[model samples]
Target: MKYEISGKKRFSAFSLYTLSFLSGVVMGLTVAPVGAWFLAWIALAPLWILIIKNEKLKIKNSGEKSSFLIALAWGIGYHGVALSWITGIHPMNWLGVPWWPSLAITLFCWAFVSLWGGIFVAVWATVMARVAQQQPWLRVLIGTAVWCGLESLWSAGPLWWSSLAYTQSPHNLVILHLGQISGPNTVTAAIAAINGLIAEAWINRQYRNKYLAIASGIFITCHLIGLLLYSRPIAQPPAAALKVGIIQGNIPNKIKLLPEGLRRALTGYTNGYLTLVDQGVNAVLTPEGALPFFQRDLMRTSLASAVQQKGVVVWIGAFGERGRSYTNSLFNVTGNGEITSRYDKAKLVPLGEYIPFENILGGIVQRLSPLDEHQVPGLPNQIFDTPFGRAIVGICYESAFPDVFRRQAANGGQFILSSSNDAHYSAAMPLQHHAQDIMRAIETDRWTARATNTGYSAFVNPHGKTLWISGYNTYETHAEIIYRRQTQTLYVRWGDWLTPILLGLSALGWGVNIFWQNDGNTELRS
Candidate 1:
């Protein structure tokens, strides 16, 4: 079937797909390090318009298939641009892999990750096309709900970053504050609804004024509500504040595990710790893999001796033994030189930390990762009970998963400690990683002290403000006073309650659409 407006020329399938891809690229630009955040408000409008057009015109025999292709194009464009930092893994000659094979691995990784993210968008588009005949308001609700639901699903996967909500981080504080209510999904729903409204207005020119007015009202209302949430204080009186030190060793990824590099790291971290202790810091934190040695070997370091002599707590990131396997773990050593608590990283980076199919890949895994053996993941819902308070910890890629922090927060985490090693990638990856931490800070309403091996080490307040950040590839030690708040935000207490409700709404919309179609109710068709 073909349908056309009186004065408008219909777009070819190729043109529509290209437009969708470009629209997604625009949306990706809205995130860091580009930081063109305002573009996000309307960046998705073109893709939504394309989907609506394809659905209305019945461009192909299978509307769902065509819609999926269109949305998949958008997803590829978005992820490809946003996660371009993945290509930084190229030139792995330093890791003993040849130049050409290293390039192939890097490109493969980029395409694989982008395609994984694109699949989620394609699934949402396929289901959304089924309910295209519904009223504009109903369609908007169903679309936003389904989109948020899919995002929640993506979060459950092993690799997830580039959330729609992170687009507003560190730039648009008001919109980001909505995260406190129900995490990033709330912000994502708002963004999707607004784009849906605009698309409806564009497609239905006869009721353009009404649709635009409704969109405007919603835009203003979301911001106003966000302002209300942002203005309120998250911390209560009598909060215990701790002066903590963060160490950025700036160790290059190539030689981090080498003997000479080990000596340099030990001397650098030990001196940084003593310097911070001289400044009267209560505790010090190191980045992930900063020690890069076993727990037993870490105790012999000068840094451990300084901690015991200075009688100050030190949170050190090192390797731990779990029976026969090794684990990327963080240890909390008290002034008495005893390891009081340890949290192993639950989410390991694919290829970087462990091979996915060891039985199949075999020796190929060694060529890719620095580790000879796979690191075992820690159990879920682990939190460190320090002298100050219960601390929520995220190691490297684990910061991308919100629920990891949310669960710990719900279990009574007073503060957040994110330990990362961003030396493998360029500045773009760390900037985006830092944005995720900001969103976590707002959602959990906890002060965050992030330490990185290379750069972007900083302190974030409960409201998602970065109080201090270090330069990239720079060796530095900074101390800041961060309060430990027992107060939990609505998101923490209620969890991701919105995602499940949205998923239910999506299911009902699909079921109702199917029922009406079976009954031959043409009246419900738009």
Candidate 2:
């Protein structure tokens, strides 16, 4: 087990960790809307290589403490940078809180979430090292297993989230179809195996190790198989056509709150709807909170001429309240000056949307809004009816969770819609956020329309392809964006089953290895 790194270590552990973390942050920008995940992949490989070499050296010197410290430090550094977008929350002018506390809360959440990635790396390093020392190929199996196992527990939906591997999907078009069969967990497993196999090669030049070759072959083969499988398009729905108009008014919060902001917001959507009406779209949609205030009665009556002229269905986002609780809501307004129905957003953002433990965090949440609990989490799942189709709506940021869209399709949503306000994060954030919709479309095999206040408003078909998108940093409108019904994917049908199987198989393999080793020793002694 000759394990020392070959060259003089250019940097101390802290410096290496910092470099790795910075790499992760910069690399993560490639995922999703950014579409630069391949760079992250290339950047991340060197970090693992460094870790493997350093750990091997420590093992040779019998430096047990350095091994864990090196591993943990790398884990912290990598995750801290990879998830830095989480800190965007700090600068928001919610309820009017000072920027510092807002940013502090967001940073704390990112720091908390970073622990999961850290734990995965910490345990994987220790286990991979022990196994690679003996059967070098086992590192590939164990690494993939551990990564998939952790991802399975998180699931890919609303309440729980998984993000690391998601960055890669947007960067490489190869995995566009990967989500159909095993979902992102498959990609995560493959990525881990690739990282592990490469690190194993760095540790030892055991060129003849059949197990390593076999493991690497199997890993690549599975991904290739996934690529082939994903080539087929989801079967289109046998349903009637629905006309829809999406308005990207690109409203700014600062301007939106001014004396004329509400009128501007209302006018933009009304004009967009009129354009759609002339274009013969059956339904018109607007981004989340296109209207600053909730005006159930006003929308029902005051806009009668426009509604009458369009003479169709309109779905829009606004503030809705019941008693003291207010909601960021979607409303179905009909042509005859009638309020058809309303669905409130569930799964509110932790600090930005609503405070979880109001008694403890109420003071903080209230500082940003007059109401402590601004929006209520609609009961588990709800779908709204529109002339265009049955739409499962998750307000902005809700699309990040896979399950929110999955269950909607399971329960009969023909298409998924996210009415979002990304104006807060600037144009770059929306472009990045659109990538999540691609995964959701794959997971559910449903078309998704993301209408944003600032930018990245786009349409994703069932196959995870973008049909149309708004220009960055601009107020815009997209019309006649056709929606489709897609055949269900394995992921949609079975939910998170693929991830659990990977975890279970790993446990079984590890247990069998232990038993087999014990038996072999006993036989030799006898």
Candidates' lDDT values, in order?
A: 0.86, 0.66
TM-score, every prediction: 0.95, 0.85
Q: Which candidate ranks first by lDDT, i.e. highest?
A: 1
lDDT of 1 by residue, 37-60 (tens): 888889877877767667777644
Candidate 2 residue spans exceeding 4 A from truth: 1-11, 19-29, 32-34, 40-94, 99-134, 155-162, 208-223, 226-230, 233-239, 295-305, 337-341
Model 1, residue 502: C-alpha shift (Å)? 2.5
Worst 10 residues of 1 by lDDT: 1-10
Backbone clash pairs for candidate 1 read none
Off by over 4 Å in 1: 1-7, 60-62, 234-239, 507-526
